[model samples]
Target: MSISRRTVLGGLAAAPALAALAACGGSGGGGTTEITYGYIPDFNGASLLAIADDRGLWEENGLKATLQTFTNGPLQIQALGTGDLDFGYIGPGAMWLPASGKAKVLTVNGVGQADRVIAQPGIDSLEALAGKKVAIPEGTSGDMIVQLALQSAGMSLEDVEKVAMDPSTVVSAFSSGQVDAAGIWYPMIDNIKQQVPDLVELAQNSDFADVMQFPNVMVTSATYPEENEATTLAVLKVLRAAMDVRAEDLDTTVELTAKLTQQDAEAVAADASNGQYYTAAELDALVGDGTVETWLTAMNEYFEENGKIEGETVAPADYFTFDLFTEAGK
Candidate 1:
């Protein structure tokens, strides 16, 4: 699914003018840059925005960035594609879908190796899920991971019924035994386990460290980097600084994220700690053929084989460009 430059530019032009207006404003001068960012509710989004606002990281880099919170990654990616969001923090699955000629990736934020597969009490293994029902938010990264985990265990979707449920409902589903297993992220994993003492961890991203790194990335439209490379690079610099501060001061980072998400500081800290922060070099290593692009290529193949999309076999490079991150790293 290699969208032509004409198609991408046309898509950008077709988007409402208000979306472009919402994405950027102001001129860079005296070391000041203004960019609009789209974010979601989790610790990753909250903490990144908090660090930029509280620690003055954005301002320090002459950036006056404002964040608009989105409900989910797909929405954020949509906004990014429409030119309403200069940058966004989203899951690998989100990146894969749109980046397959549907959207593009600007940069990597942090890798998320923390997806959890929570099961009811007495169900300790993937085999135990056979003939039982599972719950997951359909068409999300969590869902894709759950599917992969099942396949790795020699099971298929037909072996068990899947109930499409939100993350918040996972606990109730488990408590009432509506679903035998739930694939979700923390602190939702933590929250569910707290409510159901018998809840067990069947598998998690950490278990599949060799196969994939669930990267939570900061991506933007393809036109953004070309039209506003300087501003885009400036934003990434600010984000990199924020990541450094967060890695060093976990307590403050957690507190600030907690304030933003209205969750407990400990819970936020737990989530932050589980994520692997990326330095410029770390990001480079992660994306070096073995990471994001490789994973996306596989996913696209899987989707095509499974008839998820029509004749759209997209290469990973079609959806992402490492040049901007490379420049920003310098």
Candidate 2:
């Protein structure tokens, strides 16, 4: 279950190579900081950082950054665990691991009701869902959301056959008729519906879950941040710049994500609307006001309650920090 760097790299060959790590640092001295930043290709949390990469903001800040896309947060976190990644955009499941002790949350990337349970056509109700297979990404927030919707229908997860796989694989599995139902996120939901026009929505995550956030949090190896303070500040500044665009020019934001991911622009827009976007000042308040902490603590409890992780829980503040944002502003 513990994924080593070699184990993860074989699956994610698109990422920057090990040779690339030797070249990290500012370009001012004939060497640019070589950073491998990872994110999911899904519509929600990656747009801002993609915008930054597209705009050459990382380079402008004197860093040679490679933005690698992954299947899910845990894959990226696995890369982080082996030091293959200097920074990563992670979800709640992966975040819990790093948030506890391995990595540090630089800032919450994006938050929203980003999960949904989509079923094959003519299967309109939960009653139809029983005995059918429900595919979801193992250990991610979408897994929990799917379970909540099943519970709302008066059914436990045991009532149905649960299939655990990567969300990306589930999408392909659904299209191939390998799965009867799939718990997925937009634009995957949107993408699947386009491919299989008869798919039906069994439940919307927004209806049953109060604080279900498909958060892509920016994080670094815990020691990496402390050792490279200036570099961390620079990275955050570029990210802060990208998020500023999400706040100011959302249409352009959607267009960029759609173009880069080859997803529908409308689906991207719909997903973006479900969440609250953050600016630098707003991030300060979210962290300072304890809003971020409360959300993370809830995630930890929910995961623990579900038996995903078996251990004592730590405070949310243990996993998150606002120092880079604070220093970026100054």
- How high is the CA lDDT of each candidate model? 0.66, 0.70
Candidate 2 lDDT, tens digit per residue, 1-330?
Answer: 011111111244354322211233453554576677876654554686668767777777777776676655567766777888888776555656654576788888777565678888889997799999999776665676778788788888899999988767887989888889977766566667767898998877567546554455888776777788878887888888888888888899888877766677886788677666888778878778877777787777776767655355666666676666778876
Query: What's the true lDDT of residue 316 in model 1?
Result: 67
Q: Which stretches of candidate 1 lie over 4 Å from their true place?
A: 1-32, 288-292, 295-313
Q: Model 1 clash pairs?
A: 1-313, 1-314, 98-103
Give the C-alpha miss distance for residue 267 in model 2, angstroms: 7.0
The TM-scores, one per candidate, come to: 0.82, 0.78
Steric clash pairs (candidate 2): 24-34, 25-32, 25-33
